[model samples]
Structure formats: C-alpha cells, structure tokens
Target: MSKKERKLSAAEQRRKEKFLEKCSTMETEGYRMENLSFSVLQINLLSVFIALPVNFLFMFSYFLFNDFSLRSVYLPYAPLLFLLIFLLLIVVHEAIHGITWGYFAPDGRKSIEYGVIWQALTPYCTCSSPLTKKQYFWGALMPTIILGFLPGIIAIITGWEPLFFVSQFMILAGAGDFLIVARLLLHRPKNAQVIYLDHPYECGLVAFLKNID
Candidate 1:
C-alpha cells in the first residue's frame, strides 16, 4: 500500500501559508511570479564548465601577452595549504555576498540572511526583502567582480599565479549569480521598477515588476 501522506508541522504549514500569501499579494500588485530551481549539483557542474574555458582563455592571454612561461606564476605551496586557503575563501565569498546585499537592502544588514541548505550542504546569503533592479544587480555581481574577476585581472598583471588561480575558481563559484542575472535581464520589464526576493529554499529568486503607469 502507498504510505500515508505526512502532514506539515505547524511551523512548516505557517511558512507555506506565508509564501502563498506573499505570492497572492505580488499577483494582486501586478507582479508576475517566475520560479527557477537549480540543484546544488547542477550549479557546481555549470560552474566547472564555465570556469574551464575562462581559465584557459586567461592563461592563454597571459602567455601570449607576456614573455614568461606559465611556471613563473606557480607558487611552491603544499596541496594542503592550497585546500585550506580555498576553503577559507569560500567562506569569504559568501560573506561578500551578504555584505554587498546588505548595503542596499531596505532593512540594511538585518534584511540579509545566511544559511545552509541541508540537503545540498551549500551555504547561501539571501536578502529577506526585495530590492531594486540596479541594487540587486550590483549585489549579485559584487562578489564575482571583487573576489573573482578583479583579483584575477590583478594576478594576471602582477604574474601572481596563486591568486589568479583562486580568482578563476571564484568566477566559477559565481556561476549561480550569473544565471540569476541572465534571468533578470530576460524577464525584466521596460520602463518599470524591478525588485527581486530570494527564494527561501531554492537556488533562485522571485522578480517583481512595478509598471510605471
């Protein structure tokens, strides 16, 4: 026999009710709802795919532009050290997201929430309230620029192999953010104010458009 459906606990039920209520309010306010879900594995795989080519291009450019071999940038560090450093940077990466998002969040830093997805074992930083399209865009892209592209560029210029590698990894790490940005651009309304709210339990967000009527 099929197992009986399990009922939601009071808290879970209330959370679901709250989300539904929010959805209703959004619809009533002329905002459409779009849900995009990505699993942890999918995000990681995408990151890998994106990072490989990017890394290759950057390495190739560095080699072509400069007269030094790739070995010039390689740091003589133990593998364990590199792993530990990468792990630390991962924490910093999430912190960067929270800090940047908090800057533009309506409630300031308090509106930014940090937590881990138990099933995926992935950490996330999300804004509790919605933010303008510009603000959201900056918040979404800050970590990628500051921790990823910028550092990578600097490393390439200064011939710092270790930092360049770490930065490239960060770029890959930010694949999810790039995905969100793409979605926002695709569905964004012209001449309307846009705001987005992070999905509580998913790897995506909800966009709300306020038509300039």
Candidate 2:
C-alpha cells in the first residue's frame, strides 16, 4: 500500500481516497475502526518467519512414517511443468480468498477486485464489502488450508515428494494471510459491534467497530 498507489489507475486512486474519507467519517461519528494493515516489507518478512514452523511441522509429520534418508530433492515434473504449476497455484491462492469472501459478501463477487503490483509481482485480491469475524478469518486462511495443509497431509501419507514440497511453499506463501488473521484474533472490542473490511490499498483489513449505547 505504501507505494502501490503509483501503479493505481486514476479511478483506483479515487476509490482509495473515498475509503479513507469514509474511515475518517466513521471515527468522527464515534464508530472508529482499527487499522490492521501492514506494509509490504512487514508482510514479506512475516511470510517467511511465520510460515517456517508450519512447514517444519509438515516435514516432521512426513518423517514420522518415512525414512528421512530416502527423501529426494528431485521433483517428478520437468522445469517447465513445475514453473507452470507454481504460477498457477499463486493465482489460485488469491482466487480462493476471492471466492470465499465473495460467497459471504453482500454484493457477492462484484465486491472483489484482483490485481498485481507489477513492480513486486505481488498479486492481491481486495474485498469492498465488510464481513463477520468468522468470514474474514476463514477467507484469509482458506488458501493455506486448502493449498498447504491438506495437500501436505495427503502427501505425507502417500509419500508424494512433489506435493509435500508444494505444500511447504504454499504454506509459506500464506504467511501474510496468517498474520492478518492473527491480528484479528488478538483484537478485543468491549461492548462494540465489529466487522472487517479489507483495506483496498494495504495488506490487511480494517476492523470497523461501533460502540453500543
């Protein structure tokens, strides 16, 4: 979000501005929302560090049944095939977020926007509609669960080398999502109603809260 504005279209810029204005208005009205968004640098760093343990767990589970010495570094597919799958999975990762959130959004998929930060090659899906705590948390974690944990479990049982490795990478890729969900989990609002709105230009969500009288 910090420098993502440089790549935004004029209309996108206006949309971000409008969102900021709305946030300001909400604060003035005593309906302030907490900003939980992180910068690109922060998310990237979290992605690496936070996901390492998850990957290690997968590997440890695999080791429980199989001999570690028999593990091979060689993936079954050719370089080209592996590359295609890697790129496709990246797209699927964001698509999972969009589809999950869209299902619960008031306006459906229309509220979702997908784009890439060309400079950093970071692809993101943003949701305009607000969502419940469960909705946001599940939506954020869906990709990791689907692409990472499930495949990893299966690969460990079947001894599929490629799948286990892919699971590791996908889990790592979901670190940012994990961090966002973590923020949501730790936040506590007393006597206030809350809904999460994905920040259009940032790497996290805004938790809009209104106190009950």
Top-TM-score candidate index:
2
lDDT of 2 at 33: 71
Q: lDDT tens string, model 2, 1-213?
A: 464444665645766987888788778877777888887668887778788988888898898986654334554655566677778999999999999999999999999988886656789998888889999999999999999999999998998877877788889889999899889898888899887889887788888899897
Where does model 1 exceed 4 Å of error?
A: 1-18, 66-77, 190-193, 210-213
| TM-score against truth, every candidate | 0.80, 0.89
> Per the 3 Å backbone cut-off, how many clashing residue pairs does candidate 2 have?
0
lDDT of each: 0.71, 0.84
Measured over all alpha carbons after superposition, the RMSD of each candidate to the real structure, in angstroms, is 4.8, 2.5
Residue range 133-203, candidate 1, lDDT tens digits: 67877887888889888898888788777677778778877878787776666775678766677665556
Query: Which regions of candidate 2 fall more than 4 Å away from where they truly are?
Result: 1-11, 24-29, 68-72, 75-77
How many collisions per candidate?
Answer: 0, 0
Q: How close is candidate 1 to the true structure, as a TM-score?
A: 0.80
User: Ten residues in a row with the worst lDDT in model 2?
Assistant: 69-78
